[model samples]
Target: MLISNIEVIPGKRITDHLGLVQGSTVRAKHAGKDLMAGLKNIFGGELQGYTELLQESRQEAVDRMIVQAQAIGANAIINVRFSTSAIAAGASEILAYGTAVRLNDR
Candidate 1:
């Protein structure tokens, strides 16, 4: 399905609004990764481990949001948005949300 951060999808008309859909996931840091990240912190550079973790989390959240949209028979999702927060000391939560809509093919 087409997903966009904007309210409208170019070249397509919104036929129906299926309302809001959302998905979220929480991930915890791995001890080994934390150790490596800590070491990297000393040198002060990109934290690959944490970066990878957030990437994975974001993907999962988006995947889940897509599933929910599909289940509601939506052809696309508009105004897609993402949020992240530290829910715990070593854990982070990622959320994906959007307005589910049915769109004209062209």
Candidate 2:
């Protein structure tokens, strides 16, 4: 399905509004990675482990949101947005959301 952050696709018209769809996932830092991150924080360097972890989590949330859109017969998702929130000391939740819609060639 076509997914874009804009309200409309250049070559397509919105045929139906299927409503909002969202997905979220929570993840915690593993102890080994958390230790490494702590050292990196002190040394002021990029935390590669955490970066990769969050990237993966974000993709998973997007995939889930797409699944929901497909289930409701949406061919595209517009105005896509993402959010991240700390759920606990070492855990965070990532959310992906968008307006599900049917699109047809203009």
Candidate 3:
């Protein structure tokens, strides 16, 4: 499916609106990684572990959103948005959402 952050997809006509669709996932920090991150905080560098974790989490959320759209017969998703929220001291939720729509072949 065509997924875009913009409301309109250039040159593509939307045929139907399937309403909003969303997916989310929660992840907690690995204890070992958290300890490493604490050390890195003192040195002021990127936390590679958390970076990778969030990246994967975002992708998973998007993938799940696509599945929902596809199930509802949507060929595209527009006005895509993402959100991140802390679920607990060491956990966070990543959410992906968009308006599911059908696109004309042309």
TM values, all candidates: 0.96, 0.97, 0.97
As for candidate 1, its clashing pairs are none
lDDT of the structure predicted as candidate 2: 0.95
Question: What is the C-alpha lDDT profile of model 1 across 1-106, one tens digit per residue?
Answer: 9899998888899999999999999999999999999899899999988888899889999999999999999989999999999989998899999999999967
- For model 3, residues 1-106, the per-residue Cα lDDT tens digits are 8999999888889999999999999999999999999999899988999999999999999999999999999999999999999979989999999999999966
lDDT of 3 at 86: 98
What global local distance difference test value does model 3 have?
0.95
- Which ranges of candidate 1 are over 4 A from the true structure? none
How many residue pairs collide in each prediction?
0, 0, 0
Query: CA lDDT of 14 in candidate 2?
Result: 94
Winner by TM-score:
2
Model 2 / residue 33 / CA error / Å: 0.6
User: What overall lDDT goes with each candidate model?
Assistant: 0.93, 0.95, 0.95
Provide the global lDDT of candidate 1 against the true structure.
0.93
